[model samples]
Target chain A: MPDRSHTRPPRAADLGAFAPIALAALVLALVPLWAGDSRSMMTVVTTGLTFASYAVAFNLIFGATGQLFLCVGALAGIGGFGSVIISDRLGLPFLVTMPMAALLSGLFGAALSWVAVRRSLDTIFTGIVTLAFALSFQSFVLGRPELTGGENGLQVAGGADTLLRQPVEPYYVFLGLLVVFLVVYRVIQRSHVGWAFRALRDDDAAASLAGIDVARYRILAGWIGSMMLGLTGALFAHYRGFVGDTTYAFGSVDVRVLVMLAFGGIGTLLGPVLGAAVFTVMDELLVDQAQVRELIYGVITVILFLSFRQGAVPALTNAVRRLVGADQPPPREASSADTGIG
Target chain B: MVAVLIDGLVLGLQFGMLGVGLTLVYGLGGVVNLAHGQMAVVAAMVAARLMDRGTATALAVAAGILSVVALGVVIDRTLMQPVYRERSEHRVLLGLLLMLGVGFIIDGVLEWRYPIEALSLRITGGPVEVFGVAIRRGSIVASAVIGVVGLALILFFRYTTFGRATRSVIEDEEGARLCGINPGAVRTVIFGLSGGLAGIVAMTQAMTSPVVSTAGVGLTIFALIVAVVGGLGSTSGAFLAGIILGLVNTLSAFYIGTFVSSIILLLAAASTILLRPEGLLRRA
Candidate 1:
């Protein structure tokens, strides 16, 4: 049965729901003032912003479209590694290489989604296929000695540092990107494209019957998400000044992203941002112990899935909304921000 | 040619041991169990630690299997229960994420104790000539052990009442419920059985190459691909797919580079999924 609850567009100009999130981001933005030129804090905040970008980009496909593409890490790797090649070996400008990296990753994502949609593969199957793609990327990087520098990884050139030297500059760069993308996320959510994605996510057959080209929109989702990931990777590569197989490949980066999204909330805009900030802060506090880091993440992942399915941010948001009386947002409107694929 | 076939067959048998549990768990629960590989690693750790301390190999193997079975049941009851209760489209997603977390924890825990190095169980002899084909004793012994166990499992599924009940649930949960079968209990039994299979696979790994804590993902990927390609719910299909993949892997490695083989195998899996999602052998 078609859900009447989601039949209409959500009330526009109702931006009050986003007030809490804007406050949170504003608080995060003040870390620069809080640190007062501390390089470590600046660096940690920069990392937070970068991963927040990653998680948000991931949410576009995973959260909005309900596609579980595990190869986001690999897509990011392509951007990171591509930057190494373009900036260091090719010595291209940042503008040129950044877009190039984004294009490469975006195209790969599109191709993967095309394959999935064209064949009408299940979401689980899509995950499995992308996982293979992820493994393939790691294997490729690990096997290539000269191009990739093998396990030790390739060092990126100081091309980006010329534009932004201090930790503050790169930190702001990432923060700026996060702010811009958050706006972009809102735009995408309210657009016709967003409705199509949510439709397919809810029911592909129904979406198809309703005259939506499910394959085309799914590919578009993949393209948008991966392009953002690639852009994030390119910036991160320059920001970090290095790109390695271990840092960005299969299990490491993807696992962190998955855990963050799962914990913070899969469908919410603030969820990934909140998750990124929290995990990033936790990461800085426990920098040396990889074991402890994984244990905590694992424990959180299980706990969130078990007891907190709506994720922390959404659950919190819903509670507050409930307290304020019956101005409950339409299911479709609040869905992209609250309901996960589950 | 004969040697290649022999090598592939034995390796395939071992792969089958690795994959059966993953397939069963996925089939019964609609949960991917991302920690599937770690279960085997836990078994290997137990066996390797016991044998390293001078315990008899057979006794250590039995202990390892039992330990894994117990752990599997615990995980299913505690971690998997809620995931199964969820009725959302992303219920599998929740399970996958949870299992991924569990995998990370297991990896971290294993590395904390095992030093991130390879741990092995050695067979006492070198290559032996079997019907004019030179084969390593380790492969032969590993294959024999896993094959016997596989056959026993097959027998159990075909003839046992519990196995029949499990199959009924897998085939038609509503009908099975109507017939008075408790799906939850059957699921728990399958979890135990799957864990035992993981233990067997670990022992196979022990008899062959040493497995490291970090190699858990590698094991999981291999098992998942085999299960996916074989047909999601069919044990026999997974077994056949394992042999086919093993043979193809060996042939590709011989013809191309070792890394090429993995890429090729992965591509093959992708093509299989896109082209025949129900699997090459599975009935739609």
Candidate 2:
């Protein structure tokens, strides 16, 4: 039992990073109640919350650990499809199916990390490899009509109908999940596993030399990340009451996640939350300007990558902290672990 | 089946060009240009429009190639340099995402400007028979052009001092720098040359098949698979792997189904990445 705190001391201001996230969560929790059962607005907020969960899941692997898992949609689709089938056949509730589906998704994520890590390939290679998996998943779902219902997908029986009948219910349910995820994220950030992930992300050789099981931690991060993603996907499946092959299309869901995360921030927990919320609102507001919106999103993605690699949340946090400059913690080297050879 | 083989060969040549171009940049610059396919698409679109509007095919293609070459130089000097200087250990992460962003922007712009339709240039040529096989005469021409270009590349790499210097940088950047080779200059040239190669790809696609603006990601994915399977930074390996993948693609499409070909390609690439990251060709 090595002292994890000695690896990297958790800063007091690390807790300060939570202020914005907490405020954001407060707003998210109130959105459905504020909307007073307006379907369209509820839809938009829930959708944003759904994507925000994904962004959180993504941040675990891609943002925190520097492992690239580009197949979140596919993995989540796997979770969604599994949950729907299980619920239909066994007549189980979400409490039972969601975890089961998450387990399956987690295993898949583990497989993705193993496939890439075993070869000791870079993140770019990992992304390419996972992208292949993503494509194959889509092809599989589409190719098998009997199993997956093909492009039409499987309906969740009365799930979406129930949500529609009670829009505020889903709003609370998903927002609760979002809050749980934020807590989990914070726990990971401050825990021993968090320290290990940070260490592994910073320098694999150095981390491995420090008596840490690099493979173990990397795989652990993958499982955790994908499990979160899987839960979100399962919830989304129930929300839409449909899980089609196109639900995980490369051109649609995958790209959307990338854009959302890149725009908000890659590594920061709050960044993804902010990104998902901002981008979703932007998309909703500019729904009619599809082409222009896509073009703008594309441009912003590039611009953010070039100029603001740390993303919106971190930059703002730093600025706020600098202005206040009260009780400043020791400066930690911004971990450059996520960037690697393509 | 014979037509499949002929078509496969032609496709293989194009795949070879993509692999070579991508790996050249990868080996020398350590930057995988995910936007490589978009550059090709842009050129093809330009050429297709020129031909559509009643311009000479040759002149249109020449103009297209020249335009992409310039675009290549401009991209390297302006866009990519900052990505290169992004000043992080996560250059690959940031770099790939940066290029992907650029790719999407280019795609969006093209789709908006164009009719969002797949446009393929139609060349007027008669069918040709060779070795008791009938094939598209255009396919033969494209294959021959690729063959000559590939050969010229091989010869240039073997005989030219500049090529040797570039090769040196690919082999060992620091060593080449010590040996007085300007790695930066070599990389810039490779970037420009890769763009030229992308222009060739666009032209080939126009002659052989339709290319849409959104097709950049797909094309880049295929090229990435081929390059990875061939060996990330190995040229000859890419050539051989390209042919193998092309032939497999044709057979799969013929026998199983159209979508199955991509599955096989993706599977092959994933397995290669997992089981043999160095690639199966055994570059010696």
Candidate 3:
């Protein structure tokens, strides 16, 4: 890692960058106050938090950098299944297995990024390759019924004695994880890593010309982002006390995260959190219309991609900014503004 | 071994056919239609519904293919218009995401309305002997259909002026425009052609096995693998890669296990990316 301290954002801007994350964390911390009594509501909120973390991680890899990994579910599944298998088969503790699982997932992600970078695959080719990996991972899981329990899923018996299974406890745990993810994201944004990310994302050749190691930064993003996914996945498995096909299936996890990240602003700090919250509420409201739920989601995805390619958050911010009579655009944070292909 | 090889060849032809639609779209527009398989399923469902209503099979199939062609045109006109406005990487990303959403919509609609509907065409005939091996009549007929279509595509692209114009657009859109070619019109025609091809593949697939409503994603994956391996835009390359992957698929399934074949195929595609990003056949 090259010393990039000189490239760090100004202290005021760094602090300003974290303002939204802090606000989001503060608001989300209050979710359990009213919903604590209802087990179902707690589960719903916790699930939302998990998705928010996944979206944040995705934002780092895709929104920050330009690596469009289509295997979000698979990376998370590695964490979920890795921890479960380690704890169950090896009799390891949850604490030991969780980090181990995350590290393993991170390494897998790094390998993937290395391949993409070495091949110089563009966004769509990277997506295709990662999607292939994701599908293969699903097949591997499904094929190895003796190991994975296949469609029946596996029970996390190791965490059965812990408070993780408690309705409200898991919500707080996931909320804390989300906070960690947000803080990590903001810190990265203020550091030289963030500079490299933006530079490479805009134009890798230019970034390389400017002495930024594009491959190193890209692989670093992949590793860190995948670690977040793996950690959250492991935590969720333990919290829910089960891991199944649906838990990390591409449709259930990856698609939802993509929609969420896109719905929020792709590269915005609070986009994932806002998107996850809105979609979670929408999910709850459409619970009665199960058949049409996915259809509605599909329609919304299409409409959202077509109409607000940048997302609702940035659009809303722009509207508010114009209303307040600001002539110049807001200070460029980690944003998708003018994300034209170089 | 010969029997397995023959079976693989049959499967490979279908895979090649599937790849053609996806590869053509990508070559022409730099858009990988994630809904390619969904379009096929939609066509299958249409044909199935018509057949269920006592319509003749030939007429039902024609309607099914035609409906998808119309869908492709509509999508090119409406959904893809915005995608086309974006350039380079953004265009690819937007197109992919939008098509993915379309795929989900198609899947949701098909699953909701026709949960149990499936298309399985039964071509009744005795097993045909080839190289001292008996092959199913359905497989033989399906292979024949694919072969004919493949030949037709080759001829059309090689000799037709429209085909040359289409290739020119894929090669250099701006240059093609300078030469008086309407890239949008060409894309529309190819998209419709791709849709028709997808419908035909679905029909052929049904002759051997049922094409269920839920088969969209799997089919999409297969098409993608074939397209990527064959080289995104090369028609002949698709057939070549398809046969290779199809053999690998069948052989692995036979020798290793049924579950390992897909993984192997995917690994093959991933390695192809590593070794040859342009695919197996470089466009001449």
Number of the top-ranking candidate, with TM-score as the measure: 3
Best by lDDT: 3
Clashing pairs in 1: none
- Candidate 1's residue-wise lDDT over B20-43, tens digit each? 788888888877878888888888
lDDT of 2 by residue, B46-163 (tens): 8878887899988888887878778777767776776565444455556676777778778878877875656576768778788888777778777887888888887878889998
Which residue runs of candidate 3 sit more than 4 Å off their true CA positions?
A: A1-14, A309-342
Over 4 Å off in model 1, which ranges?
A: A1-9, A12-24, A158-160, A309-342, B1-4, B116-119
Candidate 3: true contacts recovered, fraction: 0.58
True contacts kept of 2: 0.56
Residue A65 alpha-carbon offset, candidate 2, angstroms: 1.9
TM-score of each: 0.91, 0.90, 0.93
Q: Least lDDT summed over 10 consecutive residues: which range in candidate 2 chain A?
A: A333-342
lDDT tens string, model 3, B1-284? Answer: 88889889988998898999999999999889999999999999999999999999989989999999999999999999988888787788778889989998998898789989999888998998988998889999999999999999999998999999999998999999999999999999999999999999999999989999999988888999999889889899988888898899989998998778889988998888778888888943
lDDT of 3 at A106: 97
- Candidate 1 chain A has its poorest 10 consecutive residues by lDDT at A327-336
